[model samples]
Target: MKHLLTIFKYALLLALSGVLMWYAVRGQDLSTIGHYIRSANYFWLGITMFLSVLGYFSRAYRWKMQLTASHQTVSYWNVYHAMMVGYLANIVLPRMGEVIRCSVLRRTSGVPVEVSLGTVITERVIDVLVLALLLGVVLMLEFNKFWAFIESLFVDKYDSLAANRDVLLSVAGIAVLLAFVFGYLLLRNLDKLRENALFVKVIAFVKGLLAGVFSIRKMENKSLFLFHTGFTWLVYYLMDYLAFMCFPETYSLDMKAGLAVLTFGAFGMAAPVSGGIGVFHVLVQSTLLVYGISKEAGIAYALVVHGAQTMLVVLMGGISFIVSAIHSGKPAAQKQMSVSR
Candidate 1:
């Protein structure tokens, strides 16, 4: 039943992606978009791919640092391979990559899954903060240009919530009461729960997870970690900025436009779809429309940029999967041989 539910969820997500893609390209001429893609400067894309590789390495190193601070001494290559394999898995299924990568690391480095997951949660929190910061900066700088577009995206939902204010308030109050009752019950039964095996295991896991999350504070060289974080985002920004040169339509776009694309494109990629397939394309194309680019040109740019990065992930991630599989198999093979002897 669990497996069936997982299958159903993925199928639903894929269908949603297909629907969004259709909506994005609905009225546009495919041939024109194809022409734009074909005429793009491949050299600029190649540069972006190189930068992407650098960004991946930086991210892996930063993760390694986090693990090290947590007192788990995993090798650099193991961390890198685990991360890339996780990325490969994400192309297959959204959000599963986090757990899969943690599992992979455990196989390769003996790191506990719960601990790694805690670190992943910390990483995601940091990323969300950084993305929010960038979004704020973009909005402040380009307020006049983007205010209406941003407002249009949220106004209806805001209005709907306002219209249902009384019901929402009631719901909130009920939720708070339920939370307090649950907390009181839990406290009353705390001793009995502590005696339960599953509860004990959960407590241990949460402790490990918290330890991993707070490992950042224990790092010996916080400055280096910060540098890598900044460098990774800089590479991301450059990838977007340089890709502007790939087409005549976007070539004249300035640094501020690059920042806007980076901000919105990151949000698109963060959407809970496989590889951000259709969502990224739609959001990016809409964003470019605000800057006077036609829908056809906007999507064309999105297609090429997204296609190139996707290809890069496939190539690098495929290689990592193969290497990690082989690397992981050796230990099992050796153990079998020892048992036979």
Candidate 2:
């Protein structure tokens, strides 16, 4: 039953991704999008790929720092390999990358899985805080523009809701019914769920995770952590900004425009889909259209930029997985040689 549920979950996500991809491609000129893709400047795309690696390297370095604060003596190379493997896993299984990454660390460095997971949680918290700050700065600079954009997205539906008392009451009733049903189900299943083996493992993992998260207070060189955190985001923005140079259609766009795109694109990538495949294109294209870019151009840009980065993740992650496996085997190999001698 657990395996069935996992399969169902992946199927549902894939279905949603397909629906979103269809929406993204709807009403766009395929030929024009294709032409733009074919004619795009490879030079800029090369630079974009380079920036993506730099961003990954920075993240791995930051992870090493966090782990060091926790008093783990893992090498930077091992951490980086684990991080890359995680990224590669994400291309297929959404958030499963983190577990895969922590598993690598546990196998290679003898770190507890739960402890590594805790550090991952800490890193994500820091990332969310940074992303929130950047989003706020972008909104402050373009308040009216974004306000108008948001109003365009939802104002008509809200106005209609205000005029329709019966529709509103029905929706509220459904929501209440759902809450009641969910609460009842939870109460009924609580004991059995707690006794499940998976549940036991999760509780143990959470305990270790908390210890890792608290290690942030013990970190050395807080300044270096701050610098890497800032630099990682900066590199991310540069990847988006340089991708704009690949097409003449977006040549007139400035850094601020790229920031807006990056901000929305970030939300799309955060969705639970493999590599944000379809959702990223839709959100990014919608965002570009808001900035007066043509739909075809938006499609082209989204395909090129997001697709290239996804490819990079797959390629580098595969290589890193191999490297990590080889590196992790060295200790056993050395011990075997000594025994033979």
**lDDT against the true structure, each candidate:** 0.91, 0.87
lDDT of 1 by residue, 98-179 (tens): 9998988887777898888888888888999999999999999999999998998999999999999999999999999999
Best by lDDT: 1
Report model 2's TM-score to 2 decimal places. 0.84
Best by TM-score: 1
lDDT of 1: 0.91
**lDDT for residue 23 in candidate 2, whole number 0-100:** 89
Residue-level error in angstroms, candidate 1, position 289: 0.7
Q: Which consecutive 10 residues in model 2 have the weakest lDDT in total?
A: 326-335
Assess candidate 2 and give its lDDT: 0.87
How far in Å is the alpha carbon of 228 misplaced in model 1?
Answer: 0.6
Summarize candidate 2's per-residue lDDT along 127-196 as a digit string, tens digits.
Answer: 8887788789878987877887778778999889889989889999999999999999978998998999
